[model samples]
Target chain A: MNGYAGKILRINLSDHTYKTEELDKDKALKYIGGRGLGSRIMAEEVPPTVDAFDPENKVIIATGPLTGTPTPAGGRYMVVTKSPLTGTIASSNSGGFWGSELKFAGYDLLILEGKSPKPVNIFIEDDKITFKDAAHVWGKIVSETTSILAEEAPDKAKILCIGPGGENLSKISAVMNDINRAAGRSGVGAVVGSKNLKAIVVKGSSKPTIADSEKLKEVVKESRGKLKDNGVTGQGLPTYGTAVLVNIINEGGVFPTNNFQTTYFDKAENISGEHLAENFLIKRESCFACPIACGRYTKADEVEGGGPEYETIWAFGAACGVDDMKSVIKANFWCNEMGLDTISAGVTIAAAMELYQRGKITDADIDDGLSLKWGAGESLVEWVKKMGRRDGLIGDKMAEGSYRMATHFGMPEVAMAVKKQELPAYDPRGIRGQGLQYATSNRGGCHVRGYLISPEILGLPQKLDRFAIDGKAEWVKIFQDLTAFIDSAGLCLFTSFAIDGEGYANLTNAVLGTDFTQEDILEAGDRIWNLERDYNLKAGIDPSQDTLPKRLLKDPIPDGPSKGNVTRLEEMLPKYYEIRGWSEKGIPKAETLEKLGV
Target chain B: MKIKVRLFATLRENRGKELELSLQDKATPEDVIQELEIAKSDVAILLVNGRDGDFSQELRESDVVSIFPPVGGG
Candidate 1:
């Protein structure tokens, strides 16, 4: 049980019953932890045929072996369940002190099943687990819920709570941990809300055991040095935050603007990381055990202490043709408190704006007296709030996510999503491999699933030609596999820029007393990835779903270095399928499955 | 020839955030960096008028030159 809590808390809300099971050492060895373990248990326990909101569908909050340990960027935790949005196995991750606190509470994972007849919240203190009535806090915003819980809970308590968006089962809702950090995307929050679970409070006074603490300390010290030496993790991110990508992505000719109609945002600099640093940033924040501290705490007009990453900036700023950073910051604050996923909520609003502009919808279709203009930050913020509250017909339509929203308006192509999930900030045409990653990602359109932008734009691990499809399939496969391992290992993917696979392997060996090689870690990633895909396939996700939106396929970027370049996804996909050991239909072959032992 | 130059990330740490530079005729982005006293090796990507540009590419009047250090985030 070295580097593990050696317990799994399983709660069944159907009968108000709970049980603790010993951590299965063999299964832990096979799947590693975090995403890997969570996916394995989900596939085995929950059938794909079950609806995401079904009482049988389980939501698992899992921590990895390195979680709460001294490893750099070790604060991450994952929420895994069948997604209401994509109907696929979803693993949404978040960072703060919660995961570490959960580990300190002496459990590696918590699995919740069934829906309570009344709203309830779970509290964990050391070995004690209590279920309290959540009626008073059920309708509150995320931060408000946590504050209310603090009146009775200990001062050291950390909370993961759902706001009104999740309580109402909005498809774009997110689970907020530590008031701000989100286990965002894939509608994981709605699943929690469906079970009448308002929040999970954790307090622990003990640390998990580690096998080789001295070696772990030494390895972490060395890796921490590497993170400090690297330019991105060391200085740029800590100073400007992830929003720094505004100017860089725009300059690289890949910053998606106006709902992916173009690759450039003319006023990108106005909302750039430099702009945030110069005008809004009051201070920078860091997650537990993280050295980079890329979190931004800033003020936009009257709203202070709202921090936004790059994706939030794009989703609220340039993606909708809004150039006002203050409004974007204000919108971001609302999304966080209301437990909304900024990417899906903002991008859905962007699609709505496009429909409005194209004469597809008019004032009659929208709120009376509210003009849904491209740069109407005020209206955009209003729509986000409405969507969170599911206020009216318009808000109800928006709660269905971008895909269903566009379909209701008779324009599914403008959704800019894959498998019903909205795309993140990076447009595929500019970053060629990113398109493939978005289409083929297990949890739907996501950048972290496989961030090729690292090599294509940031020049990490050596720069590649952005325009070329050559070596891109190989590159995508490599990045996807690497990212899968990083996500599973409970380390932030940012660590990949400084510490390579070898560094991670060494760190894992020192902490967990495992002798896994770099190749072993990568193979584990491939295995976990295939497991998630297999679950999605069983859930009826068509292999054909592994493709990009037509906008990226048919329309050439109007102007940029990527101009005239449509994503050569077809040219690269077959090669990627070949490399991934999947058939033409994107299913894992028997040999591949046998090799991975999944 | 004169162009507005914007520095980003680590490059901005060494010098000012932005500058409007006056360069000799046929001066490349490399010449602009040299004028700023920045080592050519420090720049990872350079953009002229918001498109990818080479250090050796000749600059023109009113061109917008943007330079950045290596940065990675998602």
Candidate 2:
């Protein structure tokens, strides 16, 4: 347990009781902690079909062995629970100082179970834990909640909390940490809201012991050097942040615009990363032990805060047809303040706009002074506020997410989502492997599950013809498996821009004292993937849900370089299933599960 | 042939955003980059009319050639 805190902290909200248990060493070795270990615990302890908001539904907040260690960009944690959004197992990740602080507090995982009768907050200091009444801050925004909680906690305590978005149980609500960083997907914050828990403040005095400090020192130096030398991580990211992808994606003509109706935006330059850096960037931010400062803090008018990442920009700017960078920045700020996932919130608004465009939603259906017209930048911030609070009629329905809202309007097809959760910036029609990855992501339409965009578009590790269908299934499987490992190992996915599978293994080996080969590391990733897939299968996420929207699969892009192209998902899915050792129906074969021991 | 060349990220610094480069017929993206005075290594991704562009492939009239430095994000 050299790299682990070696304890599990379980808090029973119903009875206001807590306990500590030993970490399961065997499970840790197989799952590699964080998302992997959290998913295993969810499947074993919680029924797959349980309602996400049920008192019995549990949330497992976990950190990997690499977390809190002297490893490059090893400051990440996973919030694993059944998603209110997709009904599939959701493991949302965030980077900041909280995960590492939890390790220093002597716990590898925190299991929160049952419902509290009243709003409450949990405070932890090293070995001490207390549950304090949080009725005073129950409906507050994220920054306000953090500041209020910080007043009573120890000096330098890190706070993780929900906002009005979660309090109202918005399906797209996010868990905000370190004020601006978010575990922003799959409605995880709603689970916390259901438990009547408002926030958790933690301060730890010690760090996890590294098995081989000397080896870790060497590994750290090498990885940092690699990250520094890499182009995307070293230069592009630090200089322009993740927002740099705007112009690149737009130039490729795969940047989703107008709710995916078109593949390119004529106004892309007005919202490009270069535009943001030149106009509004206040500073660059970095996570613990991260060399690539890809985070951005910006100001617009009177608002100033973190983010408006590439996806956020696309969702609010191009997807909604709004090219005003200032409005997009403000929307991003409101999203963080309201504790809502920017991708989900912005895309949900885009879906509403589509509904309006088709006459499904008329002016009579909207509140006064609100317009659903495309590129309505002035009303974007107001819509975000309503969505977070579930205010008025449209806000209440939108809080349920685009899938439900669109279906209510008798056109679920209008939602640009896979498995109920909205897709991110990249339209999959032009990027074949990315399409397959989106269709098969465990937690729904998530880009990070398997960012095929790297090899497909960025020319990293060599580029592929973005429209090619051959061998894409293999690439999808490998990227998905590797991503699962990185998410579980508590490292930033951005590190993969420089570090390969073998490099990841070396870093883990130094800290954990385990000599795992590159293949072994991949196998571990494959195991994690299967475990999530199995849980989703049992949770009623059918193989049929493993497909993109009809629009993306059938409708050709009307313009841009990707025009005349559609996602050849049908041509690649069966092959993907074969490569994954799943049946034609997308069920994992018995032998395949046995091989991975899932 | 009149090829529209778009520069992005750091590549746009002194080069400006979009430029109309008048070149001889049969010129490729390589010629376009050379005209812009950008190093080949600086061009991590190049697109012609929204598709992956080959440096030596012949360009067409009204082709939109977009060039980017090493840039990425999800």
Candidate 3:
């Protein structure tokens, strides 16, 4: 109770009824918070056999103990539910002021259940909660929805809303906040939309009380100073944002280009962070108390929005073969406005382009006669809007995401996805461990949950050859579990680049008043990972689903520094299973579950 | 041989601004740092022709070298 708001607000959309539940200290201790808490609740409450879009499924928005506290990068939250895309437990953490505001509203988590008969939005102010009719705002874009809510609620409110994409139940839809920030993966927005829930607006006046306020202030001050002193956080990120990785990853021969067919891109420099900093960036932004301020507020021509970060740049630029910076930024803005996951949207479009090029599909197949061409930014933006509105054949096919889209085209392998979700920026063939991570990730092909690229590419902690398969399994397991802890702590994983596990442990201890050691934190992270895996397992996922795409496993990188390298996933996966205390088939062993108390 | 040496992020700030360093043939990355009067500890990543290189990595003529200070990362 010292760190938590000590309440969970449950809204049953079925009957338009709402109730508040006292926070359980036992659950908090076991699950910690954020993705951890959300996963635990979903596992215990929702049946594994339930369809993700069914009325029985629950969507949980959760904040950690550190969130809303005077801690650096504490303005974070997680959206967890069974994914309509992957049919697995989907937990996507996002950064914005919403999580902190929710914490300020005296609630640790918001759990929405059952399908509503009519569109509605939930508003929470301190201890007061209201369900408002969302008929007028139901079909609005994310930006418009937020604007309307802000006008109605004034400066005190923060809204997390979806756009037409979510209303149509597009599998790649996202929940957007602060206009551009998103809980952007795994179709959590679609699940919310399926329930006829439009958004959750929160305004809180209560300030959190800590047991050792002085100690927490000191720790926060020190942490902020450390972040400011660090080069990546203090300078690189603030100046260029994550788009800086375009050149770096391209140089490493791991930047996904043309839908993972190649590693390097000749036009990478055109979309590099330097290009963004030089052309578009007008200012830098930060989430509550964060010093890094990697958020880019930029303008280009007539378009103005949060400029595409590294992932979005790669997704729209290199992955889709469009190198025009303005076009990529435009695409990013469109996706944000439409409330689509840029990664999935870009990858799905990339797949469509490939199919078009291979004569698998044609412009005639599209309702608007839109051409699917690589580097065709205009058409790409048009398709993005179409997908959001479900306007045409291409839009309808793409709304289902790459896997289903590819299947419809009679070539499922062209999807470049693992377990239905498309891969992010990294080309797994060039980074062997990342392939394993993507293949085995509980959320289906997500990189953030456990970014091994820190060690494999950036050489944080220690340097490992990006092209090597040696000892990668242990590295992946270590990073995966530790990253799970960071995600649950409501802290950005970016801080781990310079800050060690001890730094995070210290912050957690200061915020929660829990004596958490580095080992204890790692164990907690492992427990969260196992819990997610268990959820996926019960959801019918097995070892077969935990495998990389054939292209990454069989086809080698055609050129560049990593030429001839294919992901040696087989070499690392068995060892990875052993390290995770799982069986040979990647199932969490009973002993492992017992050890983690899951 | 003259090569374009660009300092970025923290390194640029630490070194006052972006710098263009001229070096002799077969000069190592360390020599460029010395020429720029940058502390060895200030350089976190050294890129020669857009690939990771160490201080001992010899620079070639016309190499577009980029040196960055340690930045907090993900």
Candidate 4:
């Protein structure tokens, strides 16, 4: 238990009951931690046939060994559950002070089960965990509820909670920590609300017990130096945050303008990182133990909030066909305060905009006088407010998310999604690798799952020919497996840009008192990925679901660098199956599963 | 002949947004980058006239050249 809490906190909100279970060391070693541990626990305990919102379904909050340590960008945590949006297994990660805080509170994972008879909040101070009535703060937005909890709980306690978005049961709802950082994907927040739990606050003093403390300190220092020396992780990110990706991606003609209809956003620079840094950025923020502090604090006119990240900027900018910086900034702030997932909400609005432009929807069809025209700043800002409280005529449809909304309008092709989850910022027509990544990601259309853009665009590790689809399957698999390891290790994925697998193995070996080499650690990553795939299979999701949207496959980007290009998923699919040791249909083979010991 | 050379990310930090550079008719992207004093190692994606072009690809008159560094995350 040197590097872990070695215990799991189980909470049953049905009757306000709770218990602590000892975690097996063998299981921990095999699964590693964070998402791997969460998925393993979910696979073992939860029945595949149950509904995502069913009381029997559980939400697992997990942290890894490096959390609460001096490792660079190591302060991270993950939320694993059956996704309300995609009905797939969901593992969303977040960085802030929360994960380390949880580890210090003496728990590795918190498993929530059943539903509360009434609204409540979970409070943890050392070993004293109790339920506090949250009926009064229940309906307030995330920030208000957070401040209220801070006032009621210990002065130094950290709070992770939801807002009206979750309270109203929006599929795009997110769990907000430290006021803004989010485990913001796959409707995990809705699951938390279904349990009638509002927030969890923690205050503790226990540090992770490391096996080689002195060595860990040295490795941590060395890792920090690597981060400082890297450009993307060090200078670019800290200066412009993730928004720096806007102009560069736009120049590549992969910015996903107007809901993937085109691959270029003409006014990209208007809402780019350079613009934010020059006009609105008031401060730069970082998570616990992060050296590449990429979090930006912004103020525009009278509004101030955590700055819109690259994905959010693209979602409200090119995805919606808008490039007004102030409007996007306001939407970002409003989304955080409302506990709404910016990607889902902004993409959903963009989907509606496409419908309106194509004559599929009319003003009469829209409730109120709200216009959803492209490049209309007012519409984007208003939609975020409407979505938070599920207001007006668009409320129920918006709450259903983009895929269902597109289906209602008979334009599912324009949904710009895979597996019912809207795609991220990158337009796959230009960056072929990420298109494959979106199609194959277990958590649906997500970027972080397997960031193939690093090679195709960013050229990290090594650059690849973005136009070629020949070896992209192999590259995507490697990145996915590698990313899985980083997620489970409780370290930031950005670290990989600086250190190799051996560097990570050194840190793990020092912390966990294990002599495993880099290959051993990578094998665990492979195991974790296969376990997740296996869980999805058992949950009745077929491998045939591994595909891009029809628009990505059939329609060509009309102009720009990747003009007349469609995602070559057909060529990569069989290759990816071969690389993954899966059957041609993309299902994991029996031998592969057993090989992973899943 | 003149070519529009666009710099991005860190390249923009060293050089200005864009400069119309005078070059020989057979000038390649490499020649343009060298004229701008940009290190080849720093270049991730080089586009000529809005198409994927390598450093060795030949440039044309009035053709727009955009050079970018490797930028990842999300």
Candidate 5:
């Protein structure tokens, strides 16, 4: 039982049949767990040519060896599948109690397959499993669905469900858990909807057993102390949540505002972390044994959900040109309740706002008789609600995401995205390495897959000039590999800022008895990255698709520290290709593949 | 010239507020800290014109320099 539940739960929705399979030690060791395991399973079981919404499409939810353990910030889980939005391999990891609960439920992984004829909800209680009719809960919002399920099940049950946005098959849907945490990005919720699965509720009292309990506890204590003493984790994140990045990124001239037309927001101060804390923060919440407690509990009259994080704040506040804290908080709450990705929703709405400003979209398109304008908080909130409900033409187009919306309006270049997924807070043009990560990311323009921002923006490990492109290619590849290890380990990426690869390796080695060295951990990360890249390549994505939008390439930062600068992707791309042991066309070399045993 | 500077996050929250700093003529970052009543251990990054500045980097007159504590980041 050490490091795993030693069982896999398989649920077939079409026949309403459920079964349990033994966990393979070989697969677990090779992939580690979480996103790495999900990627491997999806790549092998589901064909590359299969459509993301097809009946054969499978969704894999996995937790790592450390999940449900006492390791600090170890309560993360990953949802992996072919994404309806990006049309690529998608793996979105989320922080919540659900992963821990799932592990405690006597399953290391949950695999869902086949489409159901009708809606259904799955419940797991340790070794017991039940599939019940979810006809009444199918169309409910995330909050109501979760509340109803929790009431029906045990008090301690953890629920992961979607809302009307997902039921409507909205392209930007997210699966919400713990009422606030979301496995958000690349239409994972739509995949859930495609399977006609309503929700998954789990309750378990089983305790996870570790190989070396004494050694594991020591590592956990040391790691937690490091996180608490670290300046960024101890102070910045806990106090302001991720919203702290607003001011920092703005100063770097990378906080894209007004649909990537501007990098700086004059009114950014009004919607920043400092402002959010000063006005709205009610308390702090933690996931499992996390010491950071970056989750915000806000009590503003207009916003009754988790406070807008940095990405959400940037998406709704700066990108849409609406700097009001109340409006940002309200949008955050509405996105969660409606099961929409706040990052994608905000960027898509911002693109629509730009289209409206340019006379490409008429006022007649908006059902509420609203005039979408830059910095109009009221109009922004109105449109967010309409989009959630899919009310009218504007809502319909907005619900499709920015890439499709841009194509529908005949201005695809203005979408401000990579591979259909909208860009997050950091402007790639300002941070060149992030541009490479976004363009080359398996799931479109995601930051977490390989966050070079740690070095490019914050200078955590070693300070580097944000404006320069020197050694960034090597730096990005290293970060991407290390990040893969963290994601697979089910540990929060935030901890990596303070703890190095050796520290993370020790944590894994202590708990799982894997004897992972720092080099072995990084090599595993590299292998996982290559494996995902291979999957995406097999899915018809090639080197040509691994390119940034024209706007980021051509446009220069208008002001601030990075003024008169554009991303030198031309220089970095070749170097990045070389460092990854890939061909000039970005395909992994045979020797490199053999070395990693991919 | 002398000025009042405030630190933030770990540095400000842990250590007491408001550092009185004295600068030499045509002073840079090195000159300001050398003559100031501030601890070097508490300062991680220097913010001149609200942007990151090197400790050895030069400073100009009327620069609103903010000193931040040695904080880690994501």
Candidate 6:
């Protein structure tokens, strides 16, 4: 139990009872931890087809072996559950002090089962646990809820909670922690809300035991040196934060604009990171144990808070056809306050704008007096508040996400989503490998699942022809499998800029005192990937769902540097299936499952 | 020939955001950066006419050249 807390806390809300179970060491090694362990537990305990909001559905909050340790950027955790948004197995990752605090509380995992008859908050100090009434903070916004809970809990305790978006059961809601950091995808927050649980406050006084302290110290120093020497992790992120990518992506002509109808924004400079640093950025922030410090704290008019990350900026800025940086900052602040996924909320608004443009949504249909016109900054800010509150007819529909909202307007094709989950900032038409990654991502339309953008756009490892089809399937498989490893190990994906498979193996070996080679690390990743894929398949997410939006596949980008390009997914799907050791129909082969023992 | 040159991130500190450069016929992106007094190692991403470009690639009149220092994030 060198790298683990050696215990699992299972809480049954209906009975207001809890049990501490011994950790299974073998399973922890096999699945790594965090997302992998949580997903494995869900696969065994929760039925694949169970409704996401049903009392039977379980929420697993898990931390990896490296979590709360001295490893660089080790403060991370995963929230795994059935997704109400995509109806696929969902595992969302987040960073802050919360994961480390949970580890110190003497549990590797916290499993919430059954529904509470009333709103409640769970508090843990060391091994002590208590359940308290949460009537005062049940429907509050995230910052307010955190403030109230912090006052009631032990001093310096970390709190995780949902906001109005989750309380109203918005399918695009996020679980916010440390006030701003979020496990922000696949509607995991709504699952938390469904149980009538308001928050979890934890404070602890111990550290995770390490097997080889000397080895860990050397590896940590080496890793930290690599991060310091690397141009990206060392300087760029520290200086500009993630918002630096805004101008780079826009210049690449793959910055999605107006909900992907166009590939470029003419006034991108207005919303660029360079401009943010010059005008609105108040400070650079960092999560626990992070050296890159890519988090940004910005202020616009009156609001000040953490982030408007590149994706958030693109979502509310160019994608919605609004170039006002101040409005984008305000929208991001509201997203954190309301516990909404900024990407989904903003893209859903963009889809609604398209619906309005096509006359599917008339002014009469929107009684809230907010215009659906592109670049309507005031409307963007107000609609986010309404979507979080689920106010009015349009707000209620938008709360369900873009695909459902567009389908309600009789045109699901306009949503710009894959598997009913909204796509991120990049337009896949221009980046072929990313297109395949989006289509095949187990969690649906998420960039962090694979992040082909590193090699394809940022040229981290090597640059490939973004439009080329040759060997892209192979690249996708490698990136996806490696990403799975990083997520399970509780490391930030940005660390991949400096660390490779061998480096990850070294870190794991040093932490757990296990002699795992690079090949073993990747094999573990492959196993995790296939397990999630198998779970989704069993849950009725068919192989046909492995596809991009129809617009990306057929219609070419109308204008931009990447104009006249479309995702050639057809040419790569079979190759990807072949590379994954799956059948032609995209089903995992029996041999593959046996080989990985998934 | 005249080319539009764009600088971003740290590269834009002393230099401006954008500039118009005049070069001899058959000037390449290398020449454009040289005209701007930018070190070759300082440029991590180079784009000519919105496509990935090499330092030695010949530039055409009215082509746009974009340059950035080592920077990345999703």
Model 6, residue B46: what's the lDDT?
Answer: 90
Question: Could you give candidate 4's per-residue lDDT for residues B10-64 as a string of tens digits?
Answer: 7787578879898988899999878888888777677787666877877778999
**Which residues of candidate 4, in runs, are more than 4 Å off?**
B13-15, B39-45
* Model 4 TM-score (2 dp): 0.97
In model 1, which runs have C-alpha deviations exceeding 4 angstroms?
Answer: B1-4, B9-22, B49-52, B57-63
- lDDT per residue for candidate 2 within A184-291, as digits (tens), equals 999999999999999999999988888889998998999999999988998889999888888888877899998999978999989989999999999999998898
Per-model root-mean-square deviation over C-alphas: 1.6, 0.9, 2.5, 1.5, 2.4, 0.8
Q: Which CAPRI tier for candidate 4? A: medium
Q: Give a tens-digit lDDT track for model 1, residues A358-380.
A: 87777887764565788888776
lDDT of 5 by residue, A1-598 (tens): 5878888899899998989999888878888999898888998899977898898999999998888889889999999999889888888888889999999998889999999899999999988888889998988888899989988897889999987777777888898888889888998988899899989999988877889989998998899889888867887788778886776777666889998888888788788776777789889888987999888888668558775788998899899998888888888888998889999999998999898888888777766567678887767666766676677888888878999988898788889888899989988877888888887787888898787887776667877666678888888888889999899988898898778988998899888888888999899999999998888889888778887889888888777656776777887888888989999999999899889978
Error of 2 at B50 (Å): 1.4
lDDT of 4 by residue, A479-523 (tens): 888889889889988788888888898888889999878888778
Worst 10 residues of 3 chain A by lDDT: A363-372
TM-score of chain A of 2: 0.99
A234 Cα displacement, candidate 4 (Å): 1.9
Per-model CA lDDT versus the true structure:
0.87, 0.93, 0.84, 0.86, 0.83, 0.92
Model 6 misplacement above 4 A: none
Q: State candidate 1's DockQ.
A: 0.57
Model 3: fnat (fraction of native contacts): 0.24
Please write out the lDDT profile of model 6 over residues A97-165, one tens digit for every residue.
999999999989999999999999999998899999999998899999999998999999999999899
The per-candidate TM-score of the B chain, in the order shown, comes to: 0.91, 0.96, 0.81, 0.91, 0.58, 0.94
Better of 1 and 5 by DockQ: 1
CAPRI level of candidate 6? high
Docking class of 5: acceptable
Model 4 residue B48 CA deviation (Å) reads: 2.7
